[model samples]
Target: MLVALAIRDVVLIERLDLVFGPGLSVLTGETGAGKSILLDSLGLALGVRAESGLVRAGQSQASVTAAFQPPPAHPTYALLLEHGLEAEEEIVLRRVVQADGRSRAFVNDQPVGVSLLRRLGALLVEVQGQHDQVGLADPASHAGLLDAFGGFEADRAAVALAHRDWRAAERALEAARAAIAEAQRDEDWLRHAVGELGTLAPEEGEEEALAERRQGLQQGEKRAEAVAGALSELTPRDRRGGGNPAAALRNAARALERMPPPNDSIQPALILLGTAQDALAEAETLLARLVQEAAPDPRALESTEERLFALRAAARKHAVAVTSLPELLERLKERLSALDAGSGQVVALEAAARAGRAAYVAAAGRLTERRAAAGASLDAALSAELVPLKLDRARVTVALTPRPEAAWGPDGQDRVEFLVSTNPGQTPGPLARIASGGELSRLMLALKVVLARGSPVPTLVFDEVDSGIGGATAAAVGERLAAVAARVQVLVVTHSPQVAARGAQHYQVAKSVTGERAETSVTALLPAARREEIARMLAGERVTDAARAAADELLAALT
Candidate 1:
């Protein structure tokens, strides 16, 4: 509830301090007593749009501070914590508007944006005037209000949970469908690639090993060729060389033996020829053995080269390194496996999505039924309240419009609105569109009285709630205000004596001219002053004995 309001240099209000309590408090004075100025000051502190004209003449700026002490569980504390502001037992909202039309906002003495101050102010107090009612006027809040009145917290939570599950399952279904669609687009390629890689069956390091073996075989082949060439040179390929060096040497030695039976020189030559023949034979045998040892199998070399090329070709085709072929092959095979099994998985997810949606629909349908019952109850409750406030001809209807499937939300599928018909045969329409300003204020009063158990705002301010009515009608407004005050704080700026007489606390807003300046002042009225004020309201600008007596009776009746 608003504990204090401090205003300085604001239009007619030079300086004023007012303390409020947790019951219906009335402010009463003659016309132009600056009662509206007090509300304007409160509005300024509540983060309303600031204007330079609000500043008093010759004052550089105007400032208003509103202090509130809300309940421990009030949502305002959560709002404060969310904004990284201090959340103490007391919250002070201050606004300072410079003469140049600039303004600053503060909460708990910490600087904050005007927007945040406005939001916090909304949570702390709701100002309902002849022309404006905060929470009650907004359609978006109507559904939540109905739900609160209906005590559907548990039902709403269940519906919300079911909604989330449905959405999650649907999202999963979409992802799986997209995956399967993508996989099908490449199914042919996947199968062919898997088959080709499986056939090659390349090992991790086979490429390097094959290349090393091919090189060794090529070197051995070169060494074998050189050895064979040497053996050919020792045996002459032409007949001029006597078919082989050893054969030619043997023939020469035999010829020397025949001619040298008695010649000593021919004997020495034959001995030299025999020695050369034996040396040539030994050379041929050594060369032949080296050739055999160095020879490489042609088929082995060819096979190594073919295997190396095949592995490299597959790497290029697949855009992977030769060493990565084994890993790539396993990955492709897994993709094919998933493709084959994805249909069953997709079918399972579809069933899950269907079940989730069905659950949500069932929960939402139950909530809808309960809301219908609650709405009927609310209609009866509000109707009972309107008649005593001089709106007996007015009828309130709690309209529940069904929403489409796509538009369904956690609150269920109904759009709740409070509709009214001011006359018997009039078609019921939206509250704001159907009722006059005075009627609207009274209707809003009845609403507050009905939803008193559900409204979270700790303080409610009504400006001229009895603007166009008087006598018993005015008294009825006062009675409802007091009733609401029983549960929360209420403040009213009124001219009706009946309404003023109902206040537990009374203040008289008056203007006084000092020198050339006119300033507004508010004074808390005692019992004697309260009677005089109510009497003054009853008999304008006069102090009559009868009015005073009537005021006494009025106060007495309520007490």
Candidate 2:
């Protein structure tokens, strides 16, 4: 509910601070007592369009502040959370209008846009009047109002969940289709590549091993022929073996031994020949091993070189190191498999999609039924309220249009709008098109009275809703307003004493002059003062004893 409103240098109101309370609160005074000015100031503070003319004479700027107290579970709390703002018990909305016709808005002392303030204001307080008939004129609020009236939060939630499920399924289908299309685009390339890699059958480290072997052989090939040549020079090959020099010397020693018992010079020759034979045998053994090792087949070297070159080129083509060639081949093979075998997978996914969509539609259909039922109840309730408000000829209806094709929305694809017929023989049309200013206010009141049990907004204000009402009909409007206030806070600006008496708190808006400046002032009137004010509303500028007594009696009846 609105707790306080402060205005400074705003038109007739030079400086004013008005505190409000719960239940029906009525503001009453004589004609030109500045009631309209007060509501206008409130609207400006709530982010209404600003005008320089609203500024007080000789003032540079005009400012207004409105404070509201919302319930703990109010939707405004969630809205604040969504926008990264804090939510507390009290939210203060302030607006500053400059003489240049520019304005600034603030909520909780944080700078905000006027549109945002207006949106938040709507959830906190609903203002209905001749100019702003938001409550009845807007069809967007009809479905929500019905849901609130019927306590269908769970149903609404189910619709939301179904919507989420449907969207997720749709995303999955799209992703699968995208994958299939990409695979088809590369089908031919994948098949040929898969065949080539399979034939090559590359092992994890095969490229490096092949390259190393090929390099060792190439280097060994260069040296092999030279080594053979060197061996030929050391022991030249001929048809008759080239006899070892030391071995022949040893044979001469054998002959010397046969000669037996020689002199000292012969003994020295024999020793030298024996040493030469031993050296030749060792040399022969080493040369035999070296010849065997350097005799690698030239054909084997060529084969290894070819294999290594193929592996390296493939690695470069795939943008991978020789060592990563195996992994790259495996990935390409997998892509081929997907393309070849995807028909079955696609069929399965299509089936699953059908099931998911069917489930969603089923859930949405159930929710639609409940919403339709809720709309009916709201229509009946509002219709029941019309007779008492002197709108017996008016017809109230909730129009529900279902679009199965577009029905996959967060709120079940049903477009809910309010329709009305203001008089007999008139066809019902959209509320905004059919209801005139006075009719709109009364219809809004009727709908509100139906949903007044626990509305989202904590405060409700009607600016001259009794504009076309008088006498008994005015009293009935007062009774309904009072009834709504019992559940939430209501502030009504009226010239009817019947309505003023219905308020638990009565305020008087009057024009007073001080210090050469004429200004508007607001005062919270006590019982006696309230009676005098009510009497002024009842009779005229002159207050009579009978009128005051009648106001008191009306008050007595309200209690």
Candidate 3:
């Protein structure tokens, strides 16, 4: 419930502090006396758009602060908990608007976005003025209202869970289908690539080994040709002077042995000839080994080239390197497996979706039954209150229409609308469409009285809701508002004496002059002052004895 409001430097309102309690409170004043200003200030504190023009004529800024005491289950508590603020303590909302049209909001003195403050404010207080009832007019609020009235909170929870489950199953089904389709699109390419890679059978470092072997063979081919040319040049036929390198080296070594080692020149020549013979023998052995090993077949070389080119082509096709062929093959195998396994996954998802649908149907069916019963009960209760509020001919109907597709909401599969038929032979339409603003306000008052018995909001503010009502009906409206106040805090702005007289707390809003400056102020009325204010409301500027007597009677009746 809203407990306090403080305004400073606001238009017409210089500085005011008003404390409210848990009962119907009235703010009564003559026209143009800033009654609406007070409410607008409260609205600004409640996160309404701030206008720079609303600042006091000479001030740089305007501010309003509202204090509320909401229960643990109230919406403000949840929001505070979400923001990691203290939820159990009192909630203080402050709004400051600068003359430049910029504004700042604070919750519990912690700066927050205007949207956040507005959301928390909604949970704390509901200002039921002319333009503030769009939520009530919304179709979504109907099922929620019904749920609150029918005690279907548990059913609503179940429906929400079922909807979540259905979405989960739907997501699973969609994933499986997408996976299978993607795998199918690439299956043929995968198979062909895998087959080609298996045939080629490339290994790590294969490229280096093949290139080294080709180089070795090419060198061998050149050396073998040189050896054959040397062997042919050393032919044993009569045309050559030396039959072979080995024969020449052998003759030289024999001649060197015949010479004695004592003569210095002959000994040196003998030693060189022996060394030459040894070297020639080594060369012949090397040439023989090369001839035996250099059997490099062209077919083998061509095979190597073909395999390397195929690996490269495959790598390019898959946008990877030859070294990654093995990994790509593995991926291909996995994708095929996923395509095969996806069929069974789709079946499982379908079953899960069916189960979720069944659960939703059961929960929605139960909630619908309860809503129907609640509608009848609410109709009976509100119907009884209607006649006394001068709406005797208007029938308030709580209409619940089922839409299975729409039923997929957190509340369930139904759209609830509050309809009214003012008289006989009139088809019921939406209350806002059928009734004028004044009539709707009266009806809303009746509804407030009815719903206040079980309200989630902690505070209710009605601005000029009693505008078109007077005499007995105005008194009745006050009586009903007071009845609602017994449950939650009620704040009303009225010009009617009967309503003001019925307030447990009466406040007089008036324009006053202080220090040669005009200002608007509000003061809680004392017993003697309240009587005079009520009399003023009755007789305007002329407070006669009869108006005072009428005020006394109204106060007496309220007591």
Candidate 4:
């Protein structure tokens, strides 16, 4: 419920702070006493569009704040949590509007967008008047209201879940169908490619390995020619004759040894010749080993080149690297396997989708049945309230029509609307169209009385709903407001003393002039002050003895 409202520099309201409590509270005063200003100020704080004219004369800005203490399960609390905002025991909504028409909004002291504040405001309080454009005035909320009244939350949830399952199954089936169609379109080409790839059987890194082996073989062939030439020169067929360096060196050493008996130079020459012969023998043995080691196998080289070329050509044809060939082959095999199993998979998915649709249809059908019963009960309850409000010849109807399949939703297939007829032999139409301002207000009141238990809003404000009616009808309106207030907080701006007398608390709005400026003030009236005010409302500018006595009688009867 709204706990307090504060206004500063808003039109005639220079500065006003009013604390509120639960139950019926009435704001009453003479006409032009700024009663509407109070409601407008509350609207500003609730995120209505701000106007520059709302700022008081010579003031640069205006501000309004509304504080609410709603229950923990209130939707506003959930909204705050969703926005990552703080949800304390008391929720304060503040709006500041500058004379330039710029505005800012805050929730719980945290800056927020006007849209979010408006959303939260709608959940916290509902302001109903002849010109109200929010809440039940919008036909879109009718279905939700009916569900709330019918206690169909569980049924609605079941339908929503079934709808989700149906959509998911349908999506899966569509994807499968598309995949199978594409696979069938390319069946022949895919089979041929798969056969060719399977024959080639490409291996990872085989290209690089084969290229390296081929390079080594080509290099070996070049080196083998030089090694063979060196071996032939070093080791002649007849080592004793041509290219016989070892024989020649040994003969020289023998000659030197024989010619010089004890000469030092001749003995040194023989030792050098012996060393040369030993070196020649070692060179022949090393050269023979080089020839054997450098020999290349022609067949192995040919095979390596063939495999490397084959991998490169296949990689180009497939538009992939040689290393990716293995992965591509695996994927193609899987696709082919899926194609072979596509018919059975498609059949199974279709069956699942059908089951999902059947579940949704069943749930929606049950919800529709319940709504039909609840609508009838609601119509009866509202019809009972009409006669007391002086609409004896009028009737309210809850219309439930089946929507087309294209318009079906998670909430179910029924479109709910509240229709009314104000006189006999008149066709019933939408409530907004059939009722005048006074009639609409009474109809709304009756509907609210019927729906009070299901409404989530903690506060309901009626803006002079008793505009053109009085006497017993005014008293009846007061009684229904009291009934609604028993369940939720109600604030009414009224000229009816009977309505004012029914208030659990009464506030009188009065305009005052200070210096050259006019300002509005609100006073919470005690029992005596309340009686005087109600007497004034009854007597109109003169509180007669009979009016005061009547006021007393009204208050006493309320007790």
TM-score winner among the candidates? 4
Which segments of candidate 2 are over 4 A away from where they belong? 188-342, 513-517
Least well predicted 10-residue stretch by lDDT in candidate 2: 236-245
lDDT of 2 by residue, 454-475 (tens): 3577888898878777889899
Preferred candidate (TM-score higher): 1 or 2 = 2
Candidate 3 or 1, higher TM-score:
3
Per-prediction count of colliding residue pairs?
0, 0, 1, 0
Best first by TM-score, ranked: 4, 2, 3, 1
lDDT per residue, candidate 1, 66-124, as tens digits? 99999988999999999998799999999999999999999999999999999998888
TM-score of each: 0.73, 0.74, 0.74, 0.79
User: lDDT of all predictions, in order shown?
Assistant: 0.90, 0.82, 0.81, 0.88
Off by over 4 Å in 1: 178-342
TM-score of 2: 0.74
- What is the Cα-based lDDT of residue 131 in candidate 1? 73
- Total backbone clashes of candidate 4, pairs 3 or more residues apart or in separate chains: 0
Per-residue CA lDDT of model 4 for 1-559, tens digit only, reads 9999999999999888999999999999888999888888899988888899999989999999999999878888889999999779999999999999999999989999999989988998888876763566667778888888999999989999998899899999999999888888988878998898899899988888888889899988989998888777665567357666666777777777677445676777777777878888888888888888778887888988888888889889989999998888898887788799999999999999999999999999999999999999998898899988888889988888999987888888888888899999999898878888778888888889988876788999998878888999999999999999999999999989889988999999999888988878999999999989988998888789999998899889988
Extract clashing residue pairs from model 3: 407-413
**What lDDT does candidate 2 reach at residue 424?**
90
